[model samples]
Target: MQRRDILKLGLGMAAVAWAGGAGRTWAAASGGSVAAGADTLDAAAWNAARQWTRTAFGRIAHVERGGGPAALFLHGFPLNGFQWRGALERLSAHRRCIAPDMLGLGYTEVAEGQGVTPADQVRMLADLLDRLGVENVDLVANDSGGAVAQLFAVAHPARVRSLLLTNCDAEIDCPPPALKPVIDLAREGRFVSEWLAPWQADHALARSPQGLGGMTFTHPHNPSDEAIDMYLRPLVDNAARTHAYAIGLDSNVLAGVEAALKQGRYPTRILWGTGDDIFSKASPDYLAGVFGDSRGVRRIDGAKLFWPEEFPDLVAEEARRLWGV
Candidate 1:
């Protein structure tokens, strides 16, 4: 019998640069190199999304745009930075929008045993910023990215100017109770091959409610073929990359996060969706109470897990309002 049958386990789930720097001209600063993308600050393009070698995790990839205040974007679990595409474009006019594929996800390369724990993720960002010569930034994070973003804010408050946390794992409800089954499979070390292979085989089925992870998003009745390929291409066929996805599932990131937020020195804004089934409303409520002083909390009615995908413009507007930019 094949290994697939041996274990009747359940299925599982889951830049750049710019000219017009120094607020005047593009000047490569210390830390990392910044490539010039365009001639004007308002017209900078982020579509190229570049990659660089990071001392911490081999090659790291990220998308960037514009100039002025820096806004760092973080993506979440089982998904790459692509989720922030629409939002990045929307915010590109005023902010230096940036989104990096976290640790082993997206097109970033990873060694077999590289650690992607929330702690490691924090260090990775700090190093990346140091390379890019970014002094501070507004953090816009969703899903699992929020978890790392929280830790990051606590560890390096000076680097983060503001925080915008969308639906994500908060407090102790991480992986959210709904996703515990999937998390369990990841922890068991069988999720990648057993669960994903079957799902990737049928792209349409993978996007259906009865499909692999179809239950995660509330809008976009069906995930576009492009979306599936963009998000899952690396993991579906590669066992090493698949294992990389499961690398630090047991870390309790929220243990220190709440205290950090209560004692936080930077402004924070919460944007939540009331329709999410994987992450609870309570998580956002707790975050709102803590980060409320910044801009209070704004909830999206009838939106689900991937509200950014459904309403990127709305998120961009709220971000603008929250930051007064």
Candidate 2:
């Protein structure tokens, strides 16, 4: 089948599945349809709703929905706020959902000579919340964003109401072996042009056996054409964005974070995808061990690194449970 046909079938099947299954689960819990809101926010709608906040780091681009205690969603490497669109769509009804494009990725503009390490991302988030008047937030993150979430939780325990982590960099396996090739490319400042540009240019390549779909997503044509453009265009468009992108993956920024995380008694839960190749399978158990108040770990069988996007229903269900909403 052609890629466009696959996307059409996927969309139709997804709508049916959500309406029949997850919608019922959500209705049982909250007395409402999970598909109630403006379903999926495509590139145009997402861009229309985009807002910016100026900070010391740079102009931070973010999108928000709903109205209540804040819930912050973080994306993985080479992706942006768009990664959490599915989650934000479902959970926005329960909490004020915010998804920000981290510095060096997406639309977040970095200041001249600024760093985009995990540590730096943590500080940027704090500043962002402060500017937005969000005193605290329920944190949800996947992939590299998970590393930033961990650091943020430890650094500002009082500012984090709860934590939900997906497959990401852990202290025990900081900068896991799987990232070596990507890291090498980043180190040489060729990652964006050499890797992401092609995926952005060709959606089929992105969903092929050798691309993001084969590696991270469970479904072929998972990210869609609009998603591919929105997620990768910025990284490949400018020299500054590319430089910041490479800087973020240059080193093990998660070093020394474990000792700090273990001391915190914050409410935490781990959701790990067993099929992920980028992170260690033992990471969830390792993270559960480190957190003083770990609720538990939920292993998602056959799911890959980007399962949160693929399985937003599960993400929202677990997030609601963790937030006690």
Q: By lDDT, who's the top model here?
A: 2
Candidate 2 regions with alpha-carbon error over 4 angstroms: 1-40
Indicate the residue-level lDDT of 315 in model 2: 94
* TM-scores of all predicted structures: 0.81, 0.87
lDDT per residue for candidate 1 within 138-175, as digits (tens), equals 99988888888888888887787789888877876665
Backbone clash pairs in model 1 (N, Cα, C under 3 Å; residues 3+ apart or in different chains), count: 1
Across 254-277, the per-residue lDDT of candidate 2 in tens digits comes to: 777777887787789999988776
User: For each candidate, what is the lDDT?
Assistant: 0.66, 0.76
> How badly does each model clash, as a count of residue pairs?
1, 0
In angstroms, how far off is 207's CA in candidate 2? Answer: 0.9
